[model samples]
Structures are given as C-alpha cells and as structure tokens.
Target: MLAVGAAALVLPLAAGAAPTAFAAPVSAPVLRAPAGGYEELMVPSKMGPVKVQVQWARHGGTAALYLLDGLRARDDRNAWSFETNALEQFANDNVTLVMPVGGQSSWYADWTSASNTNGQKTTYKWETFLTEELPAFLEGYGVSRTNNAALGLSMSGPAALRLAALHRDQFKHASSLSGPLNWNAPGMREAIRVMMLDAGRFNVDSMAAPWSPAWLRMDPMVFAPELRGLPMYISAASGLPGQHDRPAGLGGAYNTANAMGIEVISMVSTRAFQSRLNTLGINAVYDFPSNGTHSWKYWEDQLWKARPHILNALGA
Candidate 1:
C-alpha cells in the first residue's frame, strides 16, 4: 500500500491536449457587469449563501468558465486568485471566470449526510449549487445557463469531468488537471480518507459509504460513456521532481516529497481513466509530462495550455 501520510499532507494542498471538435459555438448573451472587473456574488444554496468570486467576461461577452478548487479549498478566497494569475491571464478573454470558494474536502459533491466534524454544520450540496443554483443566479448577470466549462485540479479534477458528464448541457467543456478519476480504485479510498481527515477532520463515510453506488456515481471511469461527445482536456505528470519542486527548506522538502507521491497516484489513476475512455471510444486531448509534482506551477501551466480549448468550446 502507498504511504497515506505523505499523500495526506498534499491532499490538503492541492494537462495538455490537442484541439477537439466541440459543439457549435453558442452566442454570447447580453452581459451585465459592474464597472469593476471583479465582483463578489452571494449565491444562495441549500448550504447557505456561498461566496463566489467572478471575474467578469471581457469585451462584453458572457460565456463563463467555472474554476473549482482543491480538497483544501480556502474559506476566505479561492486559491486560484492568489496561487495563480488566472484572474489576470483571463482578464481580457471573453469568458467570465466563475470561482466558488470554500468547499474543503467536499469533493464538490452532494454529500450523503452532514459532517459535523471540523465545524461543518450544513450538508454539502455542491453538485446542486454548481449545476442548479449557481446557473440560475448567473443567468441574471447575462451569463448563458448553457454556455460554460468546468476545470479543476487535485480533488476537483474528477469533479470537473463528473459535473460535465452528469450535466452535459451546463458544462460543454471539461478538464481535469492531475485529478484521480477512479475513486473505487484500490487504495484510493484509504488515501482519500487520510487526506480528508487531515484536510478538515472530515469523515469519508459522511460523503459516501464504502464501495457504495454513491461512490460509483462519482467515479469518472464509471461515467466515461457519458463523456462521449464532450470536448475534454486531460493531463498528468510523473511524480519525479521537476524544476518547480525545488525545496526552500526542510518543510519545503517534506511537502515536495508528499507532492511527488500524490502526483504519482494521480498519474496512475489518470492513465486508468484514459484507458477507460479509450475503450469507450471517447476522444480527449491527453498530456503526460516527463516530470513534475502535484503543485500549483504545473496546474498553472496546464491551465494556460487548456485556455484556448476552453474558450473555443464555450465560444468565448
């Protein structure tokens, strides 16, 4: 079995593809934007008013790209804002960048039950919020309910695809950056359990029962057939340290080691996911780097690579 401890350290921490023929570009809706480039939206959901940071679409276009955070999603701000330059990079793109903050260890799923641990009181209803509530609210901002894409890293990587798979009408484009697609894979549940517990004192059982249908419901491999025609970009890197894995100190070294192991796990699962898609005759742009770790630098690089495809798919 893999060492769950080191993997857990990064689980709390957080691909390239060629062009695929996507659906016909959807026309942009009339956009409503505050003069400020960015706006904070309080979207109401079963969990309560969830905070979402929106970078308005540039040039008056209304196509949106939803960016989901990792397992250790911050309650204060989405890490994409601070960890990467995504906001500025997409500043001039016609697509709106919709980032929902604070879903730590939630996997962006509709949980089976509430976890009172680590002060989590409300039942997680992220699947509903992202698919149903958020879309309805964004429609008022002139963002098309149907013109959008979903991209995520680490924990949310599988989530991005799952969201697109189950709700194809909402997310036309989907991408996973170093996310393990198969949850039912051996040792995956234990790793997830360790990571979830370390990240937020969360219990995996509260999200889904062991080997339950709910678990399979979230497994991308199981839903691979659903992803048949969607435009997809998937990427992963070898666990070996790359240029970005340079350590500043002992703590940095330790974190780097954890990140490496985590990436290896992701790499394995991603390949399995790719095999499943291949078997299903689903086409996706796949990138497997020679060396890298589970860090923001690689995810940033992959996102930049995937940006063009995302814009094209959303017709942004």
Candidate 2:
C-alpha cells in the first residue's frame, strides 16, 4: 500500500507551453479495491501537478472513457467514485475509466489569464492538460491514445462537448449530462459568473476576460457544427422533483429547490443546443426527462443509458 499523506510536488511550466511527457510517478499511486478499484496518480501539468484517479477495466481493454467532474470537484477524489456506482457499473466494460480530480470552478478550460487568490497564483490550463498531457501519460499504462470518449456533468458538460468538437481526432464520442451547453445564451454569462463565485470564489473575469473570444470558442452551441459526425449524447431534467429526489425534511426542501433552479437552467441551455444541432441536421441521442432535478441520481442514470452508445462509438 502507498503511504498515506503523500506530499504533492508542484512543477510549474511556461504559460501556454505544449504538454511535456510526465516523468516517472513522483510516488507510487495508492490502489483501491475491486468494486471501486482505482489508482490515484499525480500528473504533471502546465498549471501544476494535478491528481487523476483512474479505474482500469476489469476486462483489460485499451479503450478509455474520460469522466470529468462538476464545478464543485473535490481535490481528493472524483465525485463519480464517491457519489455513484460508476466504478462498479463499468467494471466489466472493456474501457478504462479516467477521472481527473479537482477543478472547482475552472470550467475545464485554458484561461486567458491567471488568478491570484489567497497568496497563490493559479492558471487553469485544463484543456491542454486533459487533451495533451494526461493522455500522453496514460499511454504508458496501456490506455489507448485515440479510442476514447469524454463525459461530463453540469460545468463540464459544455467542456466535454467543446473538447470533442475541438479535438475530433482524440475523442470518438462525447456525452453531457445536466450541463449548460449554451454559455453565451441570454443571461447565461451572468449565471456562470455567479456559479463560479459560489463554487470557489473564482473570478469570471480572470477565467475569461470581459467578452473574451474564449467564451465564444468554448460554447458548444456555437461549435455544434464541428461535432456533426461524431456520436454524441445530451441529457437534462425538467427541474421538477421526481422519483430520484429524496429530500429529507427542511434541508431536503432547500436542496430540492436549488436543484430545481440549476436543472431548469441546464434544461433551457441544453434545449437551445439541441435546436442548433437539429438545424444543422446533425443526429445525436438526447434524453430530456419530464420529472427530475439537477442531481447525481439523474446523472448516474444518464451514464448508464449512454454507455452502450459510448462503447459502440469506441468500437468496443
């Protein structure tokens, strides 16, 4: 077993530099058990060394599925492992599960400028890290370089779509569950600013300068044409409390209300993207449930529903 309390080392690189090959693991990764089997890897990046949790396929296939986290991603573990049964659900599948830890409010994008907070200067180069660095590192461990799919929820929904659209050669399929697809849609820019603040006290201006072209480039709705031929899945809820919601008493009521609002925003934005795809004559699998909220239960169900499609795209 690897030692607990492993020290993290930061090796910063020049801004906007290409991803360098990762050196040998700074320390051996801590391995977990079967149902949630995963290896915690500290991957070197342009920003800093980021933690990536990976669950190898039980069937030992080379195909990979990169699962991105939401705005409130924890530094310690991917919420998919902590909050859902994704590891067990994909245990027998012939695809590696890649989950990068931490990103709270980063939006998984390469920011225009760095932000200084609490005496630390941080630059979010997530797009480069995920697409170039992480995959290069994973190649040594038997994960495929080209046969991959990307999935994300909430904040990462658009990120996943944008990555697939921008790097069509790297990803074969993409799925967004309860993600805000249209970033520049009316009222969405402000909503994103507020959500980023609530998630990590992050400044939206720092992430993308006022009216930066990055916003237009990152908006999946704007780049839907780029995703025309790729297999894709998009899902969202109606924001209504449904069978999956089990709010307990007053706190539960508040949680339900919050989920309702977020899911409603997701529904509206996702529908707009869907409309754009239709206008482009691009076919994509879509799941718009009538009675649900923005919560993990629905995301988990969407993952299961989209799995076959993902695997099919991967030719697994």
Candidate 3:
C-alpha cells in the first residue's frame, strides 16, 4: 500500500484557512467558462488547493483530456499551453483540455513522507488530488465523469500510465511521451534521485522509500498487464539531435548534451516497458522515432499523431 503521511490526510478547510487570491472559498471555486480562452480553477486537495487550467472545447464535448507536465512544471501555466501550440491544435476538438499546474519533481505521486524542498515543506498527495478530488470537481462543471484520457511527458509519463492502469474504469485512453516507465530498473532510482535534486533539490528517497515495494507498485512495467485492453500510445526519441536541434555555441552545445543524456535514459526505460507490453500481447500505438531528441517539438508531433486515437477512445 502507498504510505500516507499524517499531514497528508484530507481535512475540511479550517475556519480561517488562507484564502486564495483569485478564487474564493479555499475548498471549492465557482466554475465558469473563461472570459477569454481559458480559465483556472483551484481544486482543493489534502496537500492544499491545486490550480487546474481548463480550456473549453469549441464543440462543447463533455470528455476531457488531462495533460500532465514534466519535472519542471511551472505554477503559472502548463508548459503545453505556454511552450507549444497545443491550445491551437485542439481548438476545434470536442474535448476539454485539463492541465494541472505546479508539480515540479513531485512525480505526481503520493509521497511516503512530507518533503522539505528549497525550504518549503510539502506533503505530496498528487495521486489522490488528480484521480479522486480533481475528477469529482470537474464532473460538477459538466466534464465527463468516466470519459477521460490522460497524457504526460518526461517525469509525468509513467504517472499517466500508472493512473490509467490502476483506475482503468476512469480513463478510456492514455499516452506518454519521453517518459521513464520502468521505475525499479537498474540505475533508475539513482537517476531519478539526481534528476529530482537538479529539478528542485527534491529528495526522491522521501517520495518513495528506496527500493521498496512502493517503487515497484508505481512502475508501469510491473503493471503492464493492467493496461492490456486500454487504448494506449507510447512514444520516445533516440536522444539524437535531429532537425529540431539547433546548437548555437558552447552554451547550446552543453544544453544539447544534457538533453541527449536524459533522453537516452528515457529511451532505454520506455523501450523496456514497451517490450514488456508487446510480450504480454497488449497492442498499443508505439512511436519510436530514431532521430528526435527529448524536446517539445517531438511531443507536439506525437500529440497530433495520437489525436485521432485519443478522440476515438473518448467517443468524440
């Protein structure tokens, strides 16, 4: 079982809990369509209220696609909306785009213990917040309760798979782009520890005990069988610089080198997980491009490539 910290238990909003600047009532917010293009809602959770950005569908479809972010997710806006043309790509699609903000290095998991990172103490209860609280809250605002799909990149890639595997009835389809699926693989734990540290001085050992059963429990490869019948899409790059890469000078070269190393690890882990899925006879759309690196360009391409499948799964 996943360990829950004492401070992570869900509780009623205290009498004088801190009020959010934009929305009233720390527990719930009035859900309304954005005045312009998108709206932000503060969904209450055990850890605190989570800010979810919603882009209403032009066709008013009830189905939703939850898009998670990577280790460096910002609190301002989802990288999908900020860095890419995802909003424009799905403008005509008949599905709501749900993006949860600010989960840097959290891995979107329920941590065993509260962690102090950069001097801020947080009890990470992202699993409960996303799967339980956020869904229920979205349902009240006309989003489909069960007809949902999830996709993530990098750090959140495995999280998307694990959520779909464990809550098969909730998500109709799932996808991951450049995510590490095999958590317990050799050297993976240490790699994650270093990544977390680099991301925000986060300690991975506090999120899940080192080499514990919880680690295995969260590994998508270990639960590959659970995702057998789900319409799934998985993609990864070979860590090689392609047309999208434009190395300028020494700084650009250094950045590209770092990206290559991370993508190589992701490629190895994702391929191993995909191999397991194939061995288990679980059919999924696999996109293993030989020349792309771990960049938003590839993720954006994969999103467009998988758009039809995702919409089909949602019955759109």
- The most accurate candidate by TM-score is 1
**Cα error, candidate 2, residue 49 (Å):** 1.5
Give each model's whole-structure lDDT.
0.83, 0.77, 0.77
1-316: candidate 2 lDDT, tens digit per residue: 0010000000010011233443343333223223234566888889888888788866667788999987777766677876778888888887889999778778899988775542238788999998999888877776777899999988789899999999988999999998888766666676666666655567777788656688778888778899989999999999889998887899678667777777787888889989999999999999999988877878888899999999899876
Which ten residues in a row are the worst by lDDT in model 3? Answer: 5-14
Q: What's each prediction's TM-score?
A: 0.91, 0.87, 0.88
Highest lDDT against the true fold, candidate:
1
lDDT tens string, model 1, 37-64?
Answer: 8777778889988888888888767689
The CA lDDT at 200 in model 2 is 54
- RMSD values for the candidates in order, in angstroms, are 7.2, 9.3, 7.7
Positional deviation of 112 in candidate 1, in angstroms? 1.2
Model 3 Cα RMSD, 1 decimal:
7.7
Q: What is the lDDT of residue 180 in candidate 1?
A: 82
Model 1 pairs whose backbones collide: 15-235
Global local distance difference test of model 1:
0.83
